[model samples]
Target: MNAGTTAERVYDSLKRTLANGSFAPGARLEPARLAQELSSSATPIRDALNRLAGERLIEMRPSDGFHIPRLNEIGLRDLYRWNEVLARTALRMSRKSEPTGGHHIAPIDAADLFGFIAASSGSGEIVSQVASANARLAYVRHVESSIIEDTADEIGDIATAFWQRSISTRMLIQQYHKSRLAIVPTIIELIFQDTQTIR
Candidate 1:
């Protein structure tokens, strides 16, 4: 394989691991070990790790190597809130426009959405795939009308800006996963809420 393909593989492998929770928050990423695991040289591993660091998925330390970044409770809440608003806004905008002939909005399955986003973004095939994933997830939540408890209703108007255009179905899927990352903390909080309510 070419260098570019190798780098892409390395990047995809790392991202998949992160998304699947195989590597927990603050887990160390040893370049040597990663290279061995991926059957690649350290160069590509370093490159992939660096890219992940830039995405805020991993932390880079001068002397301590790389670790996954942790999302605190407050940060996680904000993430979920931001996505909810953005997604709703995008859905509203999509409704306003006339659907072109042959244009279809399919009901997106959760597993498919995750797989699409992982492949699209990790492969570096298209930048918009990330945004598309976000939209799809939002659509799912909106369709279910499940109010994400404990999230702020004060969604900023900026979300509407992202919704004004006709984003590809693929990008909508990507956006879904990206937004899912934000509300991870809320999911944990919900478990506690359930426990308290039950008692």
Candidate 2:
């Protein structure tokens, strides 16, 4: 493939790896190791790392180079709250718009559910912001499932409220974030535990 294609390919691959929580939190990302693992040169790996940093999926330090961002309890709570705000903004913006059809029940993937909510706002910018936040929260949500019981039920309720455009939609959203917020400490501990065992 061409140079641009190679870079894009590496970027996509690296983005998924980072989003999936392949590396431990606060772990330094060695370009050479990633280059060997990705079967690409260091240049493309660096490029991809730079892109991921811009998305806040990873951190880049002048002194230490690239590392997975360690999510602290406060930062994690803030992210959850910020996403709730974004989703609520979308819901408010779309209030006058009629809810679309296809309201059948299905397994609610957290990312897709949030993305759908954001898309309802009819604002591309909100959709993009929610998408980014969802990406960052992907692994944390996975950890949450282990810590927080009834996750599927919670997501299902949120999805149902959203599709029906019920008056309770906003309340459900707030509850969802509050549930996660309540367990921020436990969630952070489990995340680090998983990092130690798995990564």
Best by TM-score: 2
lDDT of 1 at 122: 32
Residue-wise lDDT of candidate 1 within 14-41, one digit each (tens)?
8776654454344578899999999999
Per-residue lDDT tens digits for candidate 2, residues 1-199, read 7879989999998887765656767778999998998889899999999988988889999989998888889999999999999999999898455445445545467787788888778999998899788878887888888877888888899888888779999999999999889999998898888777756
lDDT, candidate 2, at 163: 81
**Global lDDT of each candidate:** 0.52, 0.84
Measured by C-alpha RMSD in angstroms, how accurate is candidate 1? 10.0
TM-score of 1: 0.52
What TM-score would every model get versus the actual structure? 0.52, 0.88
TM-score: model 2 vs. ground truth: 0.88
lDDT of 1 at 166: 38
- What's the distance in Å from true for residue 12, model 2? 1.7
Off by over 4 Å in 2: 95-107
Error of 2 at 112 (Å): 1.5
